[model samples]
Target: MSTTQTQMRREIEEIPTAVDRLLSTSAGAIETAISKIGNDVPFLMSVARGSSDHACAFLKYACELELGLPMASVGPSVASIYGAKLRVPNAVCISVSQSGKSPDIVELTRAITEGGATSVAITNDATSPLANTATATLPICAGPELSVAATKTFVTSLVAGLWLLAEFKQDQELVKAIRALPEHLEKAIACDWTVAANAITGQSVLTLGRGPSFAISNEAALKFKETCQIHAESYSSAEVMHGPVSIVERGFPVIGFAASDAAEDSLIEVADALTEKGALAFVTSKKAKKAICLPHQRTDHWLTDPISTIVSFYTMVEKVSTARNINPDAPRHLNKVTETV
Candidate 1:
């Protein structure tokens, strides 16, 4: 590996500082959104795509696990294409867009807001249309992300969304964890995932996780595709054994993302089980008996653990891209801002 770094690597390294910036600067916006939400919400909805969508998925787990409130992702096309006005009265809708320029996201957010949901837009661009259309806007504060494959923006988005949820629930524990993430993420960035990277020499790989970490698995798979040009699939550990395990062959690369949560043991068992099937499986948890255990930085809380895991994965993915001689900064056929209609 060259001593030089790519834009993706720089962004990956910036995640810790970006999160610290967000926690310091975004408090007012988050407080305003929480005030609008006001605790009696029956359920929550999310609007996003790509990495932002995966961030929302992680927040969905956070919302459900932390606040005991159900959350779902509302397809932007519902309002953008079909122009359907769905009933979401007295609900909270969170729309995440790093660029905040996508027409579908803006249109759907506007429609959802008009449909009686207290909408909050999380974006890097505080002045964009989605920001203006939503009830409140929370800038991710990740600064300028030059890489086409999002790194800092994704981490900051996850932090922004989780921070909002934590404040809304008045969960001081989670809030403390959120505030402590910058330090933990610094450690996460230092974690060497070269073993997992080297195992990913094949065209296809499987990523497994459960609950919140499943969202990280999804984002990791997307990053592999975008940065390394590899075919990666993410599956919930519970769902993988149903049929997806049929594809596991000798030396198949499998990575399981496990956090210090209720789902950790089960995910570890699944990772080890895959190893029994002749797959070269790796997991983050040290409890893994058969699967290779990768060094991972655990955060102050379970919810924050997955966030750290992604930072480590980002570093590893950058190494994988470097090994393949692929320019992760400008992925083929991709642009910084994807304006969807």
Candidate 2:
């Protein structure tokens, strides 16, 4: 059975188009939020959970690097579970969700707005409760994702957040690269990572990345478990050397996601070190000496490179899941939309 037969596969293939749609249609909302956020905001806060939180993790890195604005993840439980009103004055709160209907997310967005923070919602559904509560809403325009495991929506959310950052920072380089991502993503979706897929021997696997790619590693690890039922863990290349490297045995699988950033050399070094230890390590960088180098699509900007890498990874994992006799569309004990308060 080919992966193209599954709904997850179809959604994965639609990522580039979904991103293009988001970029074309969301300019007004993104520009409006950027205009409102001006240069004087003291801090930024992100509200989300699950895959949406991973998008926040990527944005946290991008905002700090590009805009020099520090970002912190605000726990939804601060308002939903604890009923504590946060005093975040002159702060911009960005919330990411696919459905935009999660109770805790909506409640927290409301609380943030009430507490004097400018609220922004990045969601697929523009009419959801979260959108209604936020001061500004940027819809991802990913269309309907029928698969229980999110693919197009996750990528579109990342694009929406990054595009907003680009507009806010007024970085023409990043903005140009962001506009060119659809072409790069098409190349990414065509990348062949079957060698890395075959390297998975069913034992525990470790995925490594640094900076924005670290968030992609986290999402990849989750998708491995969600679709293939594979036991996978994500660690920062810097953090993996601290303790996680001890668990790596001969023939263990390790995938290193390296984008064209300053941390690429560091990630390649760790991947090579794992290969030296006899692990079947694969890295996306061409500079790896010992680890097998997997092919990846690189964009004009480092921040946008991870987007392509993840699209390639989505293709490989869908194949891995189907090879393992698992249905990629519907994983066990999972739903298309998870609502938590």
lDDT of 1 by residue, 1-341 (tens): 56688988888888999999999998999888888885579999999999999999999999999889999999989999999987889999999999999999999999998998999999999999999999999999898999999999999999999999888878999999999999999999999999999999989999999999999999999999998899999999999999999999999999999999999999999999999999999999999999999999999999999999999999999999989989999989999999999
What lDDT is reached at residue 219 by model 2? 93
Candidate 1 accuracy as lDDT = 0.94
The 10-residue segment with the lowest total lDDT in model 2: 1-10
Residue-level lDDT for 65 in candidate 1: 91
- Candidate 1 stretches with Cα past 4 Å from truth are 1-3
Extract clashing residue pairs from model 1: none
Question: What TM-score number comes out for model 1?
Answer: 0.98
Residue 185 lDDT (model 2): 95
Q: Provide the lDDT at 242 for model 2.
A: 87
lDDT of 2 by residue, 1-341 (tens): 55358898889889989999988888999988877674689889999998889899999999999989899999999899999888877799999999999999999999999888889999999999999999899999999999988889999999999999898888999999999999999999999999999988585899999999999999999999999999999999999988988998899999999999999999999999999988899999999999999999999999999989999999999999998888989899999888888
